[model samples]
Target: MGSSSLSRWLRPEVYPLFAAVGVAVGICGFQLVRNICINPEVRVNKEARAAGILENFTEGERYAEHSLRKFVRNRSPEIMPSINGYFTDPK
Candidate 1:
């Protein structure tokens, strides 16, 4: 079909649908980049403060749930051997 015929056949409402989809996709991409780039450092500093016992804790475990895990994951490039020692050695 020619371009004119295809344009005529498509409904006008389709343009709004396409625009909405584009907006949603843009938002999802922005969040993905922010999480990959930004959230890790924020989480690490907050957790590291607590890890240093500079922050208070409630009547529970010293480390917050997932704090240590996220810290290790974010810093593993520099601290992998020391972190691995936690698993490799019993005491």
Candidate 2:
């Protein structure tokens, strides 16, 4: 209604209720923001961890195959380069 009537209604006791409502809203908004902001990072971190584990699993097989090939090459030192040189020699 009138400014004087509104001013009279706005007593000091109303401030605590307004402050409590503001605090509750702030806490709820903070939780929502945290969920929105932090959830993707958690998912990406989990995917990255899974990828790292997969890489380790595959690399173990790769290293075993590489070592086996190296051992075979050491036992027969005249095959790879000889085959390549014969096939690719310009002269």
Candidate 3:
């Protein structure tokens, strides 16, 4: 087949594939933005506070401090050896 004929045959098939890929990319981008922009914990805390269900600012402050402390504790050097052992063999 001539180059012109091949191009003619392939051009029609390529468009729908490109359109589907574009739609998939757009969906993934939206999900990425939603995940980054929406903090579920903060949203819930704000809603609860607005509803008068939360008594004081100290509640959220305490939760935040506890989460930070837990995160730091998990990352301590003493924990690394056990974490690394999970990937290695017994021998």
State the C-alpha lDDT per candidate.
0.63, 0.67, 0.66
Ranking by TM-score: 2, 1, 3
Which pairs of residues clash in candidate 1, taking residues 3 or more apart in a chain or in different chains?
Answer: none
In terms of lDDT, the poorest run of 10 residues in model 2 is: 36-45
Q: Write the per-residue lDDT of candidate 1 for residues 16-90, one digit (tens) a residue.
A: 888888999999998778565544333445555465533344412333344656667756465478878888989
**For this target, which candidate reaches the highest lDDT against the unseen true structure?**
2
lDDT of 2 by residue, 17-68 (tens): 8899999999999878855554333334555657543435564555446655
Alpha carbon deviation, residue 88, candidate 1 (Å)? 64
TM-score for each candidate, following the candidate numbering: 0.35, 0.38, 0.34
Model 2: clashing residue pairs? none
Q: Which portions of model 3 show Cα errors greater than 4 Å?
A: 1-10, 41-91
Ranking of models by lDDT = 2, 3, 1
TM-score of 2: 0.38
Kindly provide the TM-score of model 3 when superposed on the true structure, using C-alpha atoms.
Answer: 0.34
Per-residue lDDT of 5-74 in model 3, one digit per residue for the tens? 8787578778899799899999999877755555333444455547654355675566456665777775
For each of the candidates, give the backbone clash count: 0, 0, 0
